[model samples]
Target: MPPSPRNLDELASALLANGPVKTLPAAPKRIRVRLGGRYVADTTRAVYVWEHAYYPGYYLPLDAFAEGVLSYPGSGGGNGNGDRESGYALATLSAGGVSTDRVIVFTRRGESGSEREDGNVLAGLVRVEFAAVEAWFEEDARIDVHPKDPFKRVDVVFSARPVRVSISGTEVARSEACFHLYETGLPVRFYLPVTAVRADLLRDSAAVTACPYKGEASYYDVVVGGVDGLGEIRLRDVVWYYKNPKIECAAIAGCLCFYNEKVDIELDGKMLERPKALFS
Candidate 1:
């Protein structure tokens, strides 16, 4: 995704088994990972390694590793995998009784384990799986999902265009001063103010999700179809809002957004096709 950027779903397609791979210069952001309440690496010297995922993982320098190195850079050390002299600086990381079980190694591109890669740019670099760590941080803010892709962008713009949403022919929400959140690789979200939504129909949902670009989000379950022949139905977690969003997306705070795929939506009186993506 260096020359031409593509979304994660494209890489997940079975037809595209072997695809184009690219790398960029080391990013300037100070990325840090925490394991068992201890900081793993807190440095700006990190490279974005985009492999199977659309968003890249941070590959920090060898020095970024604290005293948590169990085995590395030596004679046929155990890489949590049963192999010897793989040419990769395989390591086991442990802190506060938490450890990586399998496939936790600082790998080089061209080696016994990763011979398919013909280069050594990824050699001597420590790439940690996010799930193996307790928390990941960009500066001080906790990042969820995965590392934010530099190529991807999120923008919130105030718009006056009329927006409307209907569920099973029942008008749910209509707004004139809604905000449009355009996020790369996702469908555009129409974030309407709370006053524009039907608060009586909305019930608090237990679902919560986090984003690296946007902050933690709380959801709402909208109840509909309580009149005529239709039975009363509760659509679960179909709407969400970020009470406190990341600084870059502060404009979307306290705004309600419906799942464009779950409900019928119209913008400026024109019907909009339901978007197809992971959210859909």
Candidate 2:
């Protein structure tokens, strides 16, 4: 039989993992949303909607939007011809200083069937497309991907277990003061301190990726022993670290976490089973 597809097969799939969605009250804060070069929505009462298989998004009340910025271009008030099943009306958003012609906007008329019971706050609200906006800020810090989900949690705990990492029989790192990051729906990730890793064996890689749950991650290539008679082996972007994690996941800041599928992780003499995940 053909081998099954490995986790982390594609970049898009790795980033867009499946998960449940929920809507909840968000703490009142000054939310300034900008698209192109114009301020689109600025409000202090932003609602958070945690959608399944996607990141948490912000929804602003209709009054929060700037005047003459939102309009329905097509018939039936842009409701897809009175398709109430969707419970949302598609509208075009345009304003002065906006670069794009018309950005897609979803106006919630009522709670969709799929929406959670607590999502009533989303009704009569407007949700802007993240890509359509140049930047979004709660107060001062810019948010990437989407707002952090309040329901999700991330915990970083110190572990004294003997953790070892190897690639093709070459020892890459070994440590006892390793930190383990546990998050919802994802596998437990073991992060080794820089002192515990063989810094000489790792070379800075050019690749960079971002996570909505965590933050921007930098990668490194592992260069060491060869496999199957090959001269020296080089694993591309096998190690990753979040130099500045989001506020919610600040526990893993500047910590290194290896891709379990790319390296052998052994804890206290037992090899760990590589977890199958979106970015395995």
Candidate 3:
């Protein structure tokens, strides 16, 4: 005779190394993480689990997150029971031939454990904001930031705006969406999308770079307005081409990038500063 469902705990204990009722470590009192532009995660009221697959993953209390930040990208249900958990939300970011999405798996094992003295988890919960992201595949696959890693911060910040590029009297491109970066001080580079500027404006340059996070990237020379009047400007190359990207950066492949501190950047439609160093 087979055992009844009432003996499920006994079966789990006999079949698995850990008992059926496994107690996870005390959830993290606080975890600070940098995602997108802002710190998407900063809280002490949630417990996080180490994700075993893909990049290092982090889980949070479903209620700790700001509501309405997630949506299903496909026809799948918005909330469903996971393999072990009861319910959770999932979100996706896709562009070109690449994708990097996440699932917010939730469980009601012990909601009362996260409450504060005032009988409110709301006050203890952190504020979260959702912002639209581009499917820029090259940037995501090519760069990795180590928050606790101890190396000289290679990041740089651009203080200018409305960056302008031109050759002779013809303008190539200009935009105010420039980035003011703060990072490990290696080489401050800007990975721009091909669509953000003019099309077919870059010619292949004989240069390549290697990163610990991503693979090798080739180089390109800027062809301003069909001719090279400002000389040859070479940008980093692509390491691996994702024909379809999961983020907003899909149009970045085969595009010309730049050293933020080395180039002539314009602020509010005026030339302001130049790069502090030139590696290539």
Winner by TM-score: 1
**Candidate 3, TM-score vs. the true structure?**
0.32
183-210 in candidate 1: lDDT tens per residue? 9888999999988889888999999987
**Candidate 2: pairs in clash:** none
TM-score of each: 0.77, 0.71, 0.32
Looking at candidate 1, the ten consecutive residues that score lowest on lDDT are: 7-16
List the candidate 2 regions with Cα displacement exceeding 4 Å: 1-21, 27-30, 36-38, 74-89, 101-123, 139-141, 227-233, 247-253
TM-score, cand. 2 vs. native: 0.71
Candidate 2 lDDT score relative to the true structure: 0.67
Question: Per-residue alpha-carbon lDDT of model 2 for 1-280, expressed as tens digits?
Answer: 1121232123112222332256666657878888757777788877776544445777776666677666655542322312234444456566555643223233233433323233333445566766566888878878887676666677888888889999888788998778888888778889887777899888999999877778889999988965663788888998999899877677777878898877899998999988887765
Task: Return the lDDT, model 1, position 150.
Answer: 82
Q: Highest lDDT among the candidates is held by which one?
A: 1
**Between candidates 1 and 3, the TM-score winner:** 1
